[model samples]
Target: MSFFTRKKQQNSSDASLVLASLGGDRDAFCIIVARYQSLLCSVAYSSVGDVKHSEDIAQETFVEAWKKLETLQDPEKLKSWLCGILRFKVSRYRRKAASQPIEGAEDITEGEDHEAGQIGLEESAIREQEQALLWQTLEQIPANYREPLVLFYREHHSVAHVASALDLSEEVVKQRLSRGRKLLEKAMVTFVEDTLAKSAPSLAFTTSVIAAINLASPPVQAATLGAGAAKAGSLLKWTGLVTLLAAFSGVISAFFGVRAGLAQSRTQRERRSVIVLTSLFFIFAIIFVAGMFGFKHLAAQHIVSPTLLAVISQLWVLGFVFSYLWLTMYLLQKTRNLRAQERIFNPDAFTHPADSPSAKQREFKSNASLFGVPLFHFRFGTPEKNDGPVVGWVAGGDRAYGLLFAWGGIAVAPISVGIVAVGGLSIGAVGIGVLGIGTVGIGFVGFGAAALGYKAYASMSAMGWESAFSGGFSIAKDAAIGSYAFAQQVNNEQAADIVQLALFGQGYLWLLGTIAALVIVPAAWHSREVRRRMKR
Candidate 1:
């Protein structure tokens, strides 16, 4: 009889499959493998929250079950027995993974050859990221709710199948599903369901398990087929290695392209700064990648929640991309500044007619001046050569640069306030500097509705490389205190300490005060000088 015919005959009951497989029927075991691979993987995924590791645990569970088949007293309870084996394997795997460092766990190309051909490299990466996000969201849901949801979707979206697999009442499963769906949110519920359904183990997984068992025993009819399959598997391993190398080569090419661009910079200082920053960027990128691996290791070991790692990884990517683009823009801006300065230094080569309003309006100076820049200078019109550059002790209007204070559409100073502000203390719609407070703030220390920084406090989304405190979604590498948090140390009641350290730096408030006096004293003296001169 064909495999499907045999499967149909053996599918009547788990008891029959167990008895037949025990009586040396390989086809019966194959049927058993196909019957429960998805269910086992779903159970394992609820514990592990990783597709590859879950599948690995499931396969190992089946092998162990086959080896210890005689120990099972009740054939009717085969599903629960298999699940018991799976639980032990999951615990052992966690223990082993915990004992090993992340570097020691770099065995990437063992049995994953079967999966490597399913999707293109880029698509695979994108899908994995999406799945990671889904898993992270699921991590927020309680285990009881999460497990039923995962199982329900993986078990062909059948409540009856889930209830049977989990050994729960159908009504209980329905209630759990409803609660889980609510906790997951409506949009995520659909995505989680679809992802789980699509991620079920394929037929090749069943064949591989059967092939593995046949190889161990050296079966007469299956030996040749197993040998051929082994050979094919080895070839696929080489193919996977080549694909990995191709992806690595692309990264190398991009690195060289960056080097070439840095080499073409206009000035030696600009080139040196860009090169140094780019090197730092690469160094940080390496550290971030290593950190991600470590986070994954922690997740595998159950040391940290997978949700925290996922959030950190997502935030890290966003931070890295933004930093790279900002650096590139900074380089271009510096190049433009240098060219403009060149034109200013060689006015003869860039001369305009004496009667022209553009030439007449291009320069402005206040009578109350300090160090050749005015005490208060404002450029109050459209962006043109005639608008001139605003430079003063206190500058205001569009694109203002100030020695102490700047207020404009785009402002930069020791203290700045604008639509887009950059300063030691910045407050604006989008603020970026040492201390930023705005609608969207990014700095060493940031406070806003949406904040990203080393230390961030927000009413809404907040992500910090080191620490984050928020009422909404908060993610951090070290400490996060919020209603919804992802961190190694969450809700540890160290908010005051973190804030103090970020602001005063280990009780050096005196040093900070002295630094503030340096700016404040000078600004005060300059202001008095301007006022006295104005009165005269």
Candidate 2:
């Protein structure tokens, strides 16, 4: 595993250096950083035409290289890989720079105009002016020619070093340098070469790169989500589940209570009171969920602290649960009192034939059964259909209940869809399930316009205790990507990549593709069955 000693690693082959680095020899990687530092800086300078930024970019390249070293399948081409990373870094930096407003040089020198600082100010101004002129001249030279010229000077005027670094012949390197010098003004030629040579990253650069690598968190290996991230994700999932359960239970209780009030024995006042109770229950639930959403939005904008949002979330769950319990108990007592009346239920209410008048009058009803469960059952709303709740293997209506699939205004099944949907795989305007997709969704994995989950992807707003990717705003404990994002890890692509890894482990794409195939094939078959039933 120790392919070379510290002294020998300086002259080690790229493959040997890589193997050694992978085997936990920091010296081998440090050697790599030192060996390629000048080449990277020169290449970056050719693109950005700024010495400081070029150095910063080069340092960033090394860090990225360290993190992604194992991804290099061909270690003999380490130089090419490093250059590729440098190019990506440069392009990203350019994009970020383009999005920001350029500050005036006056702003930089504003506070340093004191008599005591006059000498420092004058030197700084002159240095900045020379740098600006050098960059202007460098920009005139083409990239192909400019690259060799920069590398040649920065690598101590060695044509062979430039050639090897650029993967060109020594003669080609000499040719480009000659042309690059000719492209620059005679006065600027000497200045450019002197500046490049002097600005070549020193030994301190290698040390800093090593320090950065050592200080940074280790790259995620073949591992699941981190313990803290997983715990955070679980917390979020449970909180949402609790709220959803409360909503479901409260709504169901209200529905049954109102239905029970329709008994002939119940007074008109009691019936009206039950309806009022249902209305109040719905209003309170809506306000609770809406208030939570509003507070979360405020938290994303930093108008409220995340700590306050967390406290409110806990309180929201508690409040909903308590309110639901109170509603349920009140409904239960009302039901008990109503049942005690002598003039109980209507005899016709208990009679439901297969072709009942209510069933025939439905907006759309199809109960094509497979085994005990109906394979396809489509109706209209939550109002008494077939004198009772519609149940099916694949159901759809205003309210649908299915053994396998369901879709309507309110749906619940293994896979469900509606305006308000809940199931293992749920999709609707507001969806809550293990995997959910909707305008507002909450699940283990959620995707929507506004979403909350362990791994959430949203068009506008997202909050994932583990990770979140959003077009507008995002907040996460571990990784995040968005226009306005807050997380421990914020690199857009890297954060997304981490979420993928967390979701499906190492070879996630293959797993995701296979999952898609499995789901789609079965879903297609089910759709054909549903269509056949519709045709009849």
Candidate 3:
């Protein structure tokens, strides 16, 4: 067999062995662990910067893998699975480190030395000396550069695997590796120059050590050895499945909304509101879809040339900056609303919860006025009891929901076209068409389900079922406390209002439903709205 074929067969055999282990074969598991332990330990060592911690982390990873073996749908994906777990452990360590006070480099260096001692070194004394020097050089490099280099060379992972482990893009991983190599070379050169300047007795030995380190350094290969292509294909398949699920859910939500809208009596105000919102949703959806299609087309044709790519990158950064700004504004608005509610209900409210003596001891402080209202207050209390519905009437009324529906439509549109283009009149065409139809059909079902839930909440509120239930419950309680004026209970009307508010609160979700409704609903509300508005 060819080398590549042999490699594939070996990998397949390894997977079978792992599966056998999962089926209560301990020896098989030991063999699998023995094969992979060194690589896993190296990756953990790089991430944690201490050999002992790395080995401990590696052991924990194996334990976790053992526990989760049944959940492994594909034993071949074990490497990625293990790496993901190790990355998570490293992240947790980093977070813990960040929270603690900083320690000196001496402390870190000493800790690393102590950990390295745990791995008994019975090697030739000269070889041991060389390895120690190499480790020292590695420690000198910055954490970012060191981690990637170690993962690339020691673990022998592909650019994609490394990127996934670090939660970065493939391009970013490539860039980091390139930069890291340059830095490592520079550091080695510096070490040599400094050693020469000191005129140390071990100058000859140091020179040989530097040469040996360079020779021993692993070469940077183009791709990961064996199974990288298969892993990518598997990942893409899963992504497609998720996209299909999302599309189905969106359609189901939209169906019920449309039915509820149609069932409403021919009232001018109700009809006008529905008509306007629906029209706006459709217009935005179309625009969003068009933009997405254009973007994809540009990407495919290499029309996103170098200059265009740079511009797009800059725009992406700008978009993130603006998004952060908008998020901050939204948070501030929410805070203001909360403060306003607090003041309206009780001006002299306690600054902290009644249960907290420490907080109560703190004096209430009021800040200067803004627009005749205090901007800040130390005193706080249970906020005003809002008499409005528990859920907002406009919960799902945002333009963003429509935007999401439009985006989802755009995504679905491509798949639809692809199916038709590839499967035209072939025997397999029927299957493709059925899949497309079923996918869209299921999406509509999900939309309808969500809308039905919303309509129920609205209908229950309007019919005063909430108040009736509350009154009936009140009668069953002891007459003494029930008759007391201070005894307050929520009526059915209030309960229904709460439900209605919650139902509508997430308007963006409806857009997801609308996307689903496109295939499921007789006619999508957004589409119908688009046609109605076009007439005007």
Candidate 4:
């Protein structure tokens, strides 16, 4: 059966329909919708200007009215009550649209004459384009002005009626209309030259409004996640899991368990029946599972399922990266801060290099700007007047690029871009640094959410990788990409984590851990070797 079909409903007056609807009559509710849909739509259209949006407001209004039908004080005031709800919705719409207008002033043509020689079919289209642009400009105006401006002209509403609907004084409504028109005049948009035409609503419009109302969402309070946030991210889980897993897999744990009476291997009937260590195995299984749960909780991918879970369980990557970032950023800031501490000033843009201290200015590039900020800068010099290779080049400002060898150089300023960038977002290769590609991507050895990396991308495991792939989630990792074709989501979501190490020197986000391990392990190993050499 169709949603429009009313099996037992018959023609009813507005009073009768409202009373029946209030008494929980479904058919009567549908009848009420049929009767007032056109009126409600016209009221909404007058406030909003756009027909499609007006219909939507009418639909939502009727849906809300149905939900709160029992609260209706008077059946006669049903239309008035709905109009009140609609005004509120229109206000919300205007506020959202005001921030980002249809198009900025620069996007449109300054002064184009569409009506000059055009006529018949061509003129109609041109006029429509002009009207649309004008309407969009109207939406850009302040809401205080837009409401009365739309209501008065679109609804053919008199000052008294528009005032009554908006709960405003007629004088205030008049002022709004006047101010709104003045804003439009200064907006550089061509008015359609229409004399405020008003038209009757169609039956199709009424039916559609009712249908939309029937399909609207029900009223309910939204839930929040206060508890989950409070309990998230504890490092104890990883350490506890490693400890528990080690105890179970070790040789010493099984030997301590008793074998029935003698605490030895079973013999005769007992030997024929069982190893009798099943209880010990079961205990191990439980401990292993409990430990695994905690370990997985710390991992990013062990979360993020098809459900509405977060992308990261804990901001471990962010926490780790920001630590490195704090150090790097500090170093950069320190270099900038100490530049002025010297008694002998460094040679600057205007100063001759030879006139300054013995520091070599082997090469130089500079550009000046209107403000104090330099537009471009490039310089290679020895730090602290040292003779070590003249390896520092600091180039940057309003627009700058710099490269320093040995000690390392930084390029900065607005819109900075290069191999190493600080101020602006860097887009070059090598670092594979942080997030990229909005949605789907593949990189060989790539670590983050997406992949294609020539180096074996390592981390927890990437969404996808081969032998060149490293991460917690990659399937058939380096063996082949086609191995887990159907299971891409699992493989991708499982993405690998970069451990801090490499056969050569380490790079990648995981290098921090790798660096610590390399240093500590080598020192321990060498200390033992040194002690052995002394003992011999």
lDDT (0 to 1) per candidate: 0.60, 0.61, 0.36, 0.38
Question: What is the Å distance of residue 215 in model 3 from its true position?
Answer: 41
TM-score of each: 0.39, 0.40, 0.27, 0.27
Candidate 1 lDDT, tens digit per residue, 90-187? 88877877787463246434323344577666676677777788889888888888888898887777999888878899999999999988887667
lDDT of 2: 0.61
The prediction achieving the highest TM-score against the true structure is: 2
Residue 428 in candidate 1, Cα distance off native in Å: 99
Q: lDDT score, residue 232, model 3?
A: 17
Model 1 is weakest, by summed lDDT over 10 consecutive residues, at 219-228
Off by over 4 Å in 4: 1-17, 23-49, 73-80, 87-131, 169-171, 186-201, 211-536
Using lDDT as the measure, what is the rank order of every candidate, best first?
2, 1, 4, 3
- Give the poorly placed runs of model 2, Cα more than 4 Å off: 1-4, 103-119, 218-536
For 326-352, candidate 2 gives per-residue lDDT tens digits of 664465455335433312444333243
Estimate, for each residue in 355-387, the C-alpha lDDT of model 3 and write its tens digit: 132333212223454454333222121112231
Model 1 TM-score, 2 decimals: 0.39
Error of 1 at 77 (Å): 1.3
Residue 383 lDDT (model 4):
24
Per-residue error for 124 in candidate 2, Å, reads 2.4
